[model samples]
Target: MKAVRIHQYGSIDNAALEEIPAPKLGLDEVLVQVEAASINPLDTKLISGDMKDYFPLTMPYTVGTDLSGTVVEAGLLAARWKQGDRVIARLEPGSSLNKHRGGAFAEFVVVPAQLLTTAPTKLDLATSAGLPTAAGTAWQALFETAHLKPGQTVLVHAGAGGVGSFAVQLAKYIGAHVISTASAANADLVHSLGADQVIDYRTEDFSVALRDVDVVLDTVGGETLSKSYQVLKPGGFLISIVMPPDQEQAEAHDITATFFGHRSHAARLDLISGLCDAGKLRVIVDRTFHLSDMQDGLAHSASRRARGKILLRPAV
Candidate 1:
């Protein structure tokens, strides 16, 4: 099988597409013939060794986590998923357990049966690959962690990006008044995705323009995150996916804040799939690359200019 692997953590240039032996199935695993996989910032971070402390990897690690494909084989105990079942899954990046193993950027991958979820029927398998990490993280931050409620105001930074795009749509679906920051070029795109207001980050300062937001979803850390605390009302919530929040700043602003790490949950993914099928959710694919052009894909993702998800198809 052809797979993209990094022999040692360094740069995207280190990633190579090469022929490797097919992964052997485990008692509780299912083998999936990869159709498409999505590239994320996490993939680049893992390859660059930026997350080595949280996600330690063995040399020659495969590169990817979110994938959508069809089942080709299943272990005896994993018979629940039969042949030809369309599935989507997010492989663990080894954050909690500190053991990274990624194989989504390949022709085939072995997935733990428990991690599998039925892909959305409304979207093609290639598009469904965008849902796992991006949508899952947005869902976790808004619903699971922050407990965002309807009729409240929330701010989402970089609302046109992968996780931000989903966050805007999901927050709007739940009846929140969504505000977002994006480049002026993406203003219309962000508004169409359900953002009630789109602040042009390049020309406008969000902190000075908005105030007393009920929640702030900080996808852009550093100065943006620092400024986010001031926009929230007292006792409001500030959730960041990029980095940890400053406890002192949170206390000063009388807001609750914390960093979020997305986890792979079959049930959550199933719910997302349902929303997709119902047309309440949309997958915005910025670009698609052939599996052989993984370096270009990785570089594109690292550029952080993608309007939505960047995907890789195994076949042409």
Candidate 2:
């Protein structure tokens, strides 16, 4: 099987498509023939060694986490899944650290059976590959962590990007009044995704323009995160997926603040899959690249301008 891998954690340039042996199945794992995988900012960070402290990788690590595929075989104790079952899974990086296991960016991957979820019935498998990390993170932040409610207002920064796009749609699907920041070029796209108000980050200051928001989902940290504290109503919630929120600032603002690392939840992905089947959610694909074109895919993701998810299909 061919896989995109990094021999060492340093630069994405170090990633190359190479022929590698197929992974062996474990007693509690299933072997999946990958149809499509999505490149995430986290994947790039992992390859670049930026997250080595939290997710130490053994050398020659395959690159990717989120994938949708068909099951080819199951291990002794993993009979819940069977041959030809369509599945979506997020291989948690923390779970595989130091194990030297290959990831989703390959023609075949071994996944712990417990992590697998049925793919969306209505969406194509290739597109569903974009859901696990991006959609799951947004779902976790808004509903699981913050418990955002109907009629509440939430501000989502970088509304056109992967997590941001899903955040906007999910927030709106639950009847929250959604506000988002994006370039003017993406204003229409953000609004179409259900953002009630789209702030032009390039030309407008969100802090000065909006106030008394019920929740702020900060995808862009640092200055944007600092200013987000100002927009939230007193006692409101601020969830930052990018970095840790400032504790002192949260105290002064009289609001709850937290930074959460996204974890893969089969239940959450199940719900997201239902939403897709119901036509209540969608994946906005920025581009699709073959496994052989991984360098270009990584570069596009690193550029941080992709409108939504960047997908990778295994080379035939």
Candidate 3:
């Protein structure tokens, strides 16, 4: 099997495509003939050691997490899935519960069956590869954490990007007044995705233009995250996917602050897939690259300007 991997954490230049043996199946895992995988910011962060304190990597690590593929073999203990089943999964970063095992940027991958969910029936397996992490993160933050309600106003930063795109759509689906920040060029794109208002971040400061927001989803941390607190009304919420929110700022502003770390699980992926199949959700793919072009794909993801997910087809 051909896989893109890095011997050590450093840069995208360290990632290379090499032929390696197919992974061994675990008692509760399945072997998948990988069709496509999506490159995420987390992929680059993991490769560069930015997240080492949280998700320490094992040497010679494979470089992807989100994937859609067909099951070719199943372990004896993984009877829930079988050969020919099309599935989408987000492999979790190494934590105490799950060991580090990221090999999705490959021709074949062995994944714990518990992480696999049936691919959305309305989407092709290739497109479905973009759903697990991006959409799941938006779903978890809006519903699970903030509990955004209908008629409430929510502001999503980076509206044209992966998670932001989903957040705009889902917030609108839940009947919230969705406002999003995007460049002027992507204004129409974000509006079409359900943002009621698309603020041109380059032209206007969102904190000054909008106020009394019920929920602010901050994808751009640092200065932007700091300014987000000013837009929220008293008792509002600020949720960050990038880094932890400053507790002192939260108390001073009289708003709740939380940092969301996305969890990948079959059940959450299943719910997201159902929404996609029902036409309430959509996946926006920014670009697709072959395994040989792994560096270019990683570079694009690292740029952080993608409209949505960047996909990699391993079998290409």
Per-model TM-score on C-alpha atoms: 0.98, 0.98, 0.98
Q: Report the C-alpha lDDT of model 3 over 129-148, residue by residue, as the tens digit.
A: 99988999999999999999
Off by over 4 Å in 1: 95-100
Whole-model lDDT, candidate 2?
Answer: 0.93
Error of 3 at 256 (Å): 0.4
Q: How close is candidate 3 to the true structure, as a TM-score?
A: 0.98
Which stretch of 10 consecutive residues in model 1 shows the poorest summed lDDT?
94-103
lDDT of 1 by residue, 236-290 (tens): 9999999999999999999999997888898999999999999999999999999
> lDDT (CA) for every model shown?
0.93, 0.93, 0.91
Report the C-alpha displacement of residue 67, candidate 2, in angstroms. Answer: 0.4
Off by over 4 Å in 2: 96-102
Show pairs that collide, candidate 3. none
